[model samples]
Target: MATTGAVPMITLNNGVEIPQLGFGVFQIPPEDTKEATLVALREGYRHIDTAEMYGNEREVGEAVRESGIDRDKIFVTSKLNNGYHAPEAAAKAFEDTLSALDIGHLDLFLMHWPLTDGGYVDAWKAMEEMLQGGRVRAIGVSNFKQHHLNRLFAETTVVPAVNQIEIHPYLAQDDMRDFDREHQIATEAWSPIAQGKVLDDAVIERIARRTGKSPAQVVLRWHIQRGDIVFPKSVTPERVRDNFAIFDFELSDADMSDITALDRAERTGPDPDVFDYIPS
Candidate 1:
């Protein structure tokens, strides 16, 4: 279900239709984000993904505000930094995020990474409070595996609405996708193009050649056809627009299988399950 100019929405667990294909500015320099995000907006991307750790929420917000697009028409997602795991600290973190973005209510708020400090329960509780307070429209987890999600589910009745993870052909994560499907949680793909690693794959290249699309577009199209909400980040305005141009084409069944066959369990980002993250 490719969303044309119709905002390309995906129904979130909370009944919010998030754009299935969105723009991401991860790792973009903070100083360069405003112009980049504004370029994305002009290119017809209605959804934007950012994080407190990214240190560019203000720039994203500034770009959104300057775009002159109606607030209701755009969906923005931000994550809580690892340092704010305490329940009491969660509220402050959200407030800080809102202040940085200068937005009224968050479309989605997620735990950036499940830190080893064991503030997740407190963090979840704080997110619940914010949800109730109308500060965040929905709550979710990021980079969390089944164990972390299970731990959270065991403590809270409100299941996470979404799980944003590093997903691409190299790391398909079928188990995680199955878990989300059974639990009614939406799986969002970060680094949906495998950080461009799969571009040179023989299978991926074949599909791209057959489909008349770039390898990146072919991979992103595979993610979307596989029922994953993908946010592929690019700083170049032309690339940003080109990334969103996947809607016009569809991958055949053979193309889908060939792309899926490229899964190698390879992961590009840090594994949230085990990482000695020391906050700066």
Candidate 2:
């Protein structure tokens, strides 16, 4: 059914379908989130991804409420912050996020990172409790590598349904994607355009020129063609609309290969292996 938006959705392991292309508010301020999210909604984006650490859940919720779109038609995603990994605090943290968002329930909730601290295993167990208790529809993780996923799967019964990570043409995380596929986890792409770095890349530009699309569109379309759910963030209304425009185009196999060849194992964000650097 194309999931009721310009972009289509992919079904998760738990049977919930999320919009494949989503609006993300990574560094946007709380005040700006409402307007930006409203703009994205107007631009035909049905999925919205935010996190507790983003500090704009309330504003995103306000925009969602004010948009007049039925709640069931929109997919809202938020993540648990790193500091709230302990089992005791996990549910409380979700409550706080719910309060801040002013929403009844989340479409998806993710553990922001897999930490070296012992709290993560407990946190995973708590997430299962919340899932069964119906506080969250889907539970997942972010910034998790295969090692982290292996450790998590070794100790926990419930496998994360999604793993949000830094994935773009430059940092495709192909190996991790294969591992997630083997484990039945969906790989969600954060910074799917390399935070706009690929906009000026020669390979992307070549494809963009040939396709009569912008470099950003080429990069985002690459993700769509690769079967990755990508949430690209942009505060500017035009850019928000521009990012969603990728749905109309399709990248060819050669084009996809060209983009894939650009992978450098480069990351614009933090390394997933170093949870110790994350703040308490």
Candidate 3:
């Protein structure tokens, strides 16, 4: 396959640039994270997404520092865990993340989830203070729905730079993405392939054959074409490299429509509205 050496960069509302495609460390065991992340960097990934909830920040940071690439070249994002949404806990969690990663500063920090009745306004204030101090380049949310976002809009001072959510062929999240776009907040698709369920979908498989790419690649390409930032996870070495190769191909409008039409409003993860899990 021929190569085009650039991964697309999406500029957030605050004028920060983020690579449209990144390496996600969700569900990867802490022991395996460093090797997986290092492989991603070596294969031309300049962004990495990890979270305190994932229990892999230390390894992700270790890989970033050890990649032999300059630290400034990578865009790293991590989230505050669910238990830390209060103002004081949020503040402490941010420092804990920095210490765990051992990275001098963070490129992006996010509130991992909107806990039920969680004091997000206070958490947002804490995040805003961190942003003001210049340690975190950007602050955003994950698993946030429109209502959750609207609450922040009404009570907080800064707009979220990104909304990391569960989206894939079966759960397109069109409305949420539209709202994010309307507000200039980047929509980042997590579980971008529906957690491997869509790879075997007949529609996606057909497109994969047409594009001479794997089913997973086709789905990821669809995400990129739809203008959503995506980070597909794979610990398998070949698949890791394959996931990053989406930058070179183009999905046609018809293909995009066909994929979009396959939406079943299905989700591979918890719905933010009702999910109230607070990890210990």
Candidate 4:
């Protein structure tokens, strides 16, 4: 069995440590989330990324409890949904997340999006309060572009500990990753596989053939070599275990560059800057 020690830890700007590799529960139905999350936990994935919008925090919480791993040993992250950007609404939403997860406190909490609606600044303020109150160990923003982060820095005092964005070999996002690095903010890659779109690419396939790894594994290794944190979502038990097995190998510099050269700036998810839809 793999142990937590096998996973590399990345320290946040505020000194909180997170597993560089984790399990993400996005687009997972509530009923299946518990089983899939349990598989991940048992497979030695100590970090779990989830969002309130995913509507499965309760299941994630259930899995955490059932896994019998010490709560303190697990790094759990959840995000405030898009509709709850107002200060009061954000506060209530966070409280709801805590209740839903049934976890005493969150390891990390994020502003799910930089909503164009005028309330995001206030939402950030709420997150600041959550941090000071000790409800969350670290705070961050997801889907924030460089300009969005610039505005956030101007309006807030606590720099976000992380900026979670869409990154994959096909959409390397080098500039955004560099910007996050310059500001001491950790870059967390969501849709790290390009939603399976890059899995069939010839470049990634060639790297996979040479490395004796799956195309998904090669792409994941590329993200790891680039110093970006990634959590690939998979409901399959074998895949859950396979994803955790990446720490055993390293990617060559040339292979890393070749995979990086495949970037076309494509995104499988919404563009953060212009996406402002709030689901009902």
97-194: candidate 4 lDDT, tens digit per residue: 99999979999999999977757788999999999999899999999988888878899899999999999988999999999999999999999999
lDDT of each: 0.87, 0.88, 0.91, 0.91
lDDT of 3 by residue, 27-123 (tens): 9999999999999999999999999989999999999989999998899999988888788889999999999999899999999888788577788
Clashing pairs in 2: none
Model 1 TM-score is 0.96
Task: Please report how far candidate 1 places residue 36 from its true position, in Å.
Answer: 0.5
Query: Model 1, range 197-220, lDDT digits (tens) per residue?
Result: 889998888888887889998888
**lDDT, candidate 1, residue 57?**
97
**What TM-score would every model get versus the actual structure?**
0.96, 0.96, 0.97, 0.97
Error of 4 at 33 (Å): 0.3
